[model samples]
Target: MSPTTRVLNASTKALYRLCLLLPLLANHEASAEPLVIELHIPDAPPLTFVNDPRGHGIVGDVAVAAMTRAGYTVKIHVLPWARAQKHVSEEHDHLITPLSRIPTREDRFTWIASIMPMERAFFSLERRVSSFAQAKETYRKIGVGLGSAQEDILRSEGFSDEQIYPLAIGDNPAQMLLMGRIDAWFNGVPESRYIWPKVSKRKLLMSSVGSNADLYLACSKQCSPEMVEHLRDAVEALRADGTVKRVHDLYLPQ
Candidate 1:
């Protein structure tokens, strides 16, 4: 073969090899570029907590795992429940996890996935009440976290403004119940169970007031539908692979 022809053939072979590697290089770069997502979580323990040195709890772990599997990098911000909801609602591309799926909040944000079922109930000193109706008759003041789903549920149940006691941020209603400031405390079962032992040693009575509601990952309206579906599918994959249950078991009360 002529010298020029040999050189041209060698160059063509090298160019073909480079072309084969280009797609792989592009794919690696795309995979390395993780989609950064902002997550807002509440301090509700056993389900979610910020006190841990790692800044995560059960739901936090589950959320991080799911988002990671969905090809995104997660940035978790622990905030008060009200503030978390507000941030997710007002900010673009923000998400809040483990929020109750209620009618009042259905249209406020894009629902991503159902994380777990939450039981809404009223907690009082043992023997104080057997049922919600009895509790309403026995307790004049019902304590609830201010602007919480518990408060909204109570109102929907026909609780008057005079009968409802809204507790400030970081306030524990179980302590208020023990202190006799309120006759009954309203909150989710998981949160109430986690807080009861921390606040008081007294036995408490629990009466379910509302149906079990599924907690969800809610994103800002500005979030695209494709992103929401991606998260939903991620959660489903986690659940199917037992990742969700494994994470929940790690933080569950033993």
Candidate 2:
């Protein structure tokens, strides 16, 4: 009836609406700020790089995209291959990318998604070995990434540690081969090809595939179930939507 009463009633209604929206606004703010996750990667090129301004690499790009899609703000750490693996293994809920999914590593990390196929081979400057056995016999010293699946595969195949020259990833294994420090370099086929041109002009003789595996976006055993599920679903969607293939083609164009 009175102007003051009408104004009071309108204010009360407005206050009620504001109160109702407070809880929703809080929830929205909480979701707007994404969960921060640490992502570790090795320096292997065309797969994951340490200092590249454009991006990490093929699989690295995929991992970042998946994590972003899963509502995570990724904090990337570029470490040595072995150190990255150890960091992820020891740190709770931390993630590592392009890790080979092997039997020995199956239980060490919680697998999120398979990023790409990992096909390993031996590359030599002067020789073309057909098989692992031939490589073991023909090469006096074989260069393998330290603490990499390639090293484990070599050891499992009966190649003694004395014959295996373990080098850190991104330490220029191709240079070691070119300098005659190692007779051959054994690593992922894509990585070897990607690095050979960067380090040398000579032709690299590649051997047949030494092993087959899939590189995965994996996390520590203590990773949360929700995180795993979200990342897994994001990766699957990326795969389905051709985002993963597009990222791969950036480095390994066919």
Candidate 3:
């Protein structure tokens, strides 16, 4: 070939190679920019909490592992349940987990994955009450955490607003029950069980009141669809590989 023709062909090849590399370089730069994810967790022990001196908990660990695997830089903030839910509802790209999937909240957020199954129950001081019907008829007051699914369930079960005693986050309802401040306590099985031993020696009369609810990791409605899909895939993979179960087991009472 002529020298001029050879030079032109070489230039064309180089230009094509550069064109191919440009998009890849751009993608690399985008990926290098960390995906900043915020998780709003409550102080629910053995499920999600900041320990006295450390920060790892069951749901927190699972979430961090899954998101890290999915290439996100995660930042978890421990806050009151009400505040957490508010942040997820109002803030863009915020996440909350170990949240019970209830009818009222179904449309508020994009549910990413089911993390655990939870049962809501009514508990009275040992031998104080037997059936839910009896408790309803006898007790004039019930203690439940404000802004919790348990509180909603109680309201649906015909408990009047006057009969409901709303406790703040981190307040021990079991203690309230023992103090006779409330006739019964309505809460999740695991959470109630975890707190009962610390507050009372009497065995609680437990009566299941709600159907099994699945806890989920959910994101704000304003979260990008791409981010939601990424998180969903990561959590699904963790469940499939037993990482979720493993993390739960790690925090179970020994």
Candidate 4:
């Protein structure tokens, strides 16, 4: 009925689920050799946020499953958006998933790619919105989710930081816009829901605001290219067998 009530409900369900997870993971030997992976997922939910030892949600589950299928043990680590990038860059023997692959990131790491599509999501008030170019010029400010790839893309596309605002993971960027804190918010698709209800209360609109991109599983520069190739094959098999789409359709928001 209320925003506080909704958040409270989600929080309680999370705590209840966590209490049941430790004994389950601790007691089991994984079906395949355990490979340590540094899954690079953000706090935005129904995507890669943790449900604990199970490491619940779509991207995380697909990675763990693919790793297991490839005969490697898996370990999931959650990082602040920035630290996750740093960890995958500097850490040895770790893998980061759901990372975007563009010319800029080319040759930076070994990659395991997916046919799956993802987007850099953004939103602004319906009544105030216009062509992206006009919005860029007209709005006094825009909110970018901190630690996101959107930063580089927007910068390369010529967005001035003077027009940019940054918000933490749980901050409601939509609310920020509705409250006149920013003009729009840019982030991943699943993240929009995080601030939707908040904006709805103010009768503001939220809509998709960026181009689509391919997502990948990236390993550190030190990881073997052959290993990366194997991971690529494993993911390809998952796609052929329909596991990738099944998971994609199942957990990810439409």
Clashing pairs in 4: 33-73, 34-73, 35-72, 35-73, 35-74
TM-score of candidate 1 versus the correct structure, residues matched by position: 0.82
Model 1: ten consecutive residues of lowest lDDT: 126-135
- Encode model 1's per-residue lDDT on 1-254: one tens digit a residue: 99999999999999999999999999999878988999888767777776787447677777877788888889888676777787788778888877788888888888889988888777888545556677667778999887678787877878889889988533478778899988888888777887787787778888755557888888997887878888889999989999878777777745
The digit string of per-residue lDDT tens for model 2 on 1-254 reads 99999999999999999999999999999989988999998888899977788688999999999999988999998787788888789889999998998877888899999999989998898989999889888999999888899888888899988899998787567889989999999899988887888887899898888899999999998899999999999999999999999988988899
Please give each candidate's TM-score.
0.82, 0.88, 0.83, 0.74
**Each model's RMSD to truth, in Å?**
3.8, 2.7, 3.9, 18.1
Please report the candidate that would top TM-score against the real structure: 2
lDDT of each prediction vs. the true structure?
0.79, 0.90, 0.79, 0.68
Considering only N, C-alpha and C atoms within 3 Å, which residue pairs clash in candidate 1? none
Which segments of candidate 2 are over 4 A away from where they belong? Answer: 1-28
Candidate 4: tens digits of C-alpha lDDT, residues 1-254: 99999999999999989889866776665533355655566665555666645355566677777788877777677778677877787766578866777666666666676645666655766544434566577666778766666666667667788877777654556667767778777666665654476447555454545667777777886786766777888888988899877877676446
